[model samples]
Target: MVTILNEQAEVDVTPLPRGGDGLWLSHADMTRATGFELKSEGLCRGEICVPVPKGRHDFARDDAIDIAGFWRYLGHPVAHDASRSVWALGTGAGTRRQALASLEAPDFTLPDLDGRPHALSDYRGRKVFLVSWASW
Candidate 1:
């Protein structure tokens, strides 16, 4: 059993594909993590249904549905651990598409060299060039 958490909730479930993050998740796990179910129409939560793309509705060797693949097909972001047990799926394609359409960076506060915080919104109309390099 693996525990997956999002911003608001967490659920324990068996992740498919043994050890690899193969885009698949057990139906129960997927439904609990996301409020949607893998329905005939698509991933549906309540009255709304986001149709899964044809051929992309592939399955894992164990026959679990590929929830991650569905999200990727819709252009949503997702992340999981090396164990393929935990996951953090981000906002769906609709939300991201709207953000992309607006072309606005979400407001963020970052710390400068002096430990002072700078908010992107503070320079609303001005252009800022950020050149960052790190020696890891």
Candidate 2:
């Protein structure tokens, strides 16, 4: 089984014919890992659709899709620790650029000292002072 780390979730899917850097998953596993369904139009998640390259054998074979290869084809970042069987996928550069173009910070929720949940949106419309420290 391989664990895929996406923006909002971590999904585990068994990889078929396990070898090489490519992460091949079945149709159901693909959807479970990436929320994308292989369609005649390409990979579609809701209204968003990404056209699969024509004659690209590296992307799909025998009902399995190489998600890592497909993500690379879309110019997205993919990081993997094969020993750990974990992969992390990042948003494409274009998506990051568009997000950066918007000055507003994305909303996120975190627990406070008392284990109370606090969301960034909760402090919206007011100046928020944030201090973060992490031991690397």
RMSD of each: 7.1, 2.8
Per-prediction TM-score, please? 0.54, 0.76
Candidate 2, 51-82: lDDT as tens digits: 76666657877578889988887789999984
Q: Estimate, for each residue in 20-112, the C-alpha lDDT of model 1 and write its tens digit.
A: 445557777778776778777867989979876665455422346666676665576778888656777677768767877898875667778
Every candidate's lDDT: 0.69, 0.85
In model 1, where is the ten-residue run with the lowest total lDDT? Answer: 54-63
- How far is 88's C-alpha from truth in model 2 (Å)? 1.5
Error of 2 at 117 (Å): 4.9
Clashing pairs in 2: none
Tell me the TM-score of model 2: 0.76
lDDT (Cα, 0-100) at 23 in candidate 1: 54
Give the C-alpha miss distance for residue 120 in model 2, angstroms. 2.7
lDDT of 2 at 127: 93
